[model samples]
Target: MHFVTGGAFHGKAKWVMKTYSASRNMEGWFNLYEAECPETDQFETSLVVLEGMEQLVKKVVQENKKGTREVLQKKLQSWLEWESDVRGRRLVLIGTDIGKGIVPMEEENRRWRDVSGWFFQDTAMAAERVNIVWYGLEQTIK
Candidate 1:
């Protein structure tokens, strides 16, 4: 698994697309911004690019208030297992760096930030490669 993160509009998606030469017409490119994550059986491409994970994390945190981390972890583990199930198959996750800057006053917003941070941390730990993009530049962190 590869994890890529950066501030909104920092070119994370552009970097990923260029790095992987990915396109929407590709068989297995799943950008969460456009559609939902596909099930393992439905995954039909060698590479899967998953964007907008922070929003998914926010949804999970909001819907499963008591088990947000557990649920996200489970989903991560499932994706990792699927990636490992076949040689050459890869999972590329792109998330916005929403945890930085000023903290939100709303309780729900704060919770979203906190959970998204933890979720991103978990993904970075599990990922074989981690990167941060700034101003359209890529820097490998893991």
Candidate 2:
């Protein structure tokens, strides 16, 4: 599995798709969040809807606060199912803009940044490879 992430509008999904398309391997999965709307596409893609960064963070926080190995395993299982059923590939790309810096507002914005950071970290742990995009450049983080 591969996890590609970076700040908002940093082009992480773009780079991952380009790389995936260029790969000689015919079998692979691509899942993108926020970058595209969640509707069935002919091509393999899983789009997760979070509404906004705040909602996304809240989900992460709630998950973490309720931490359990079983819960983590279940999350991983769900991801794998998407890869298999939706994308049909052992190699998978889960893309998101989880590295965006904190937004200075109230508890909501701060919580978003913190929760997103943790989400990225968890994704990286689950992925065999992790890439961070900056200025259209790809840097391996794992």
Candidate 3:
């Protein structure tokens, strides 16, 4: 797994496209901003790019406050296992960094921020490569 995180409107998406778009067998991007949330069985390409994970975390938190972390962790594990199950398969996750700056006043917003941060930490730990993109620059952190 390759994990990339940075502030919104940073160069994360551009970097991802430039770095991985050469592969002809790569899957159509599963962007949470546009499509329905994807399941493990839905991925069927050599390289899988998943964008807008922070949104998913927010959705999970909103719908299942009691089980948000568990649900996401399970989903993450399933994705990781799926990637490992197939040789030459790759998983790239792109998430906007939402844990920075002034804390939100709303309870739900604060919860979303905390859960998203924790989820990102878990992703970074499992990822083979971790990067932070800022000001159109890429910096590998792990």
Candidate 4:
């Protein structure tokens, strides 16, 4: 598992496409904003890219009416099932750094940001490699 993250519009997608030579194969891109998230079995490729993951997690938090710790953990565990669908040896997860900047005034919005940050931290811990792309430069953190 590889975690690639940076600020908004930091050319993360471009870097992944270029670095992985994705144009050579049919790369699967999972967009979080879609009405229905793509099923893992729907994709077959050498590279599986989960884009807008922050949004996906935010949506999950929003949908969980209880917002309890147990509920959150169960939701996250279900989401992690995608890890099984990583094509070949690559599963590049791209998330926006939501921890930067000021805290939100709305409690719900703030919780979304906090949960997203925690997810990123945990992903970095488990990832075999973590890369931060800033201004088109790559920095390997782990």
TM-score of each: 0.94, 0.57, 0.94, 0.80
Q: What CA RMSD would candidate 4 show?
A: 3.2
Candidate 1 local distance difference test against the native = 0.89
The residue-by-residue lDDT of candidate 1 on 23-128, one tens digit each, is: 7678777767767666778888889888899988878877876889999999999999999999999999999989889999998899999999999999999999
The candidate, 1 or 4, that scores higher on lDDT is 1
lDDT per residue for candidate 4 within 9-45, as digits (tens), equals 8988788888877742355777665634555566466
RMSD (Cα, Å) of model 3: 2.0
lDDT per residue as tens, model 3, 1-142: 9999999999788899899864323465788887667987888777888889999998999998687888999989998999999899888999999999999999999999999999999999999999999898999899
How would you order the candidates by TM-score, starting with the best? 1, 3, 4, 2
All candidates' lDDT scores? 0.89, 0.52, 0.89, 0.73
Model 1 Cα shift for residue 40 (angstroms): 2.1
Which regions in candidate 1 have their CA more than 4 angstroms from the true location?
none
The true-versus-predicted C-alpha distance at residue 86 of model 4, in Å, is 8.3
Worst 10 residues of 1 by lDDT: 30-39
Poorest lDDT segment (10 consecutive residues) of candidate 4: 68-77
Question: What residue runs in model 3 are displaced by over 4 Å at the alpha carbon?
Answer: 22-27
Q: How accurate is candidate 3 locally (lDDT)?
A: 0.89
Query: Where in model 2 is the C-alpha error above 4 Å?
Result: 22-55, 58-73, 81-103
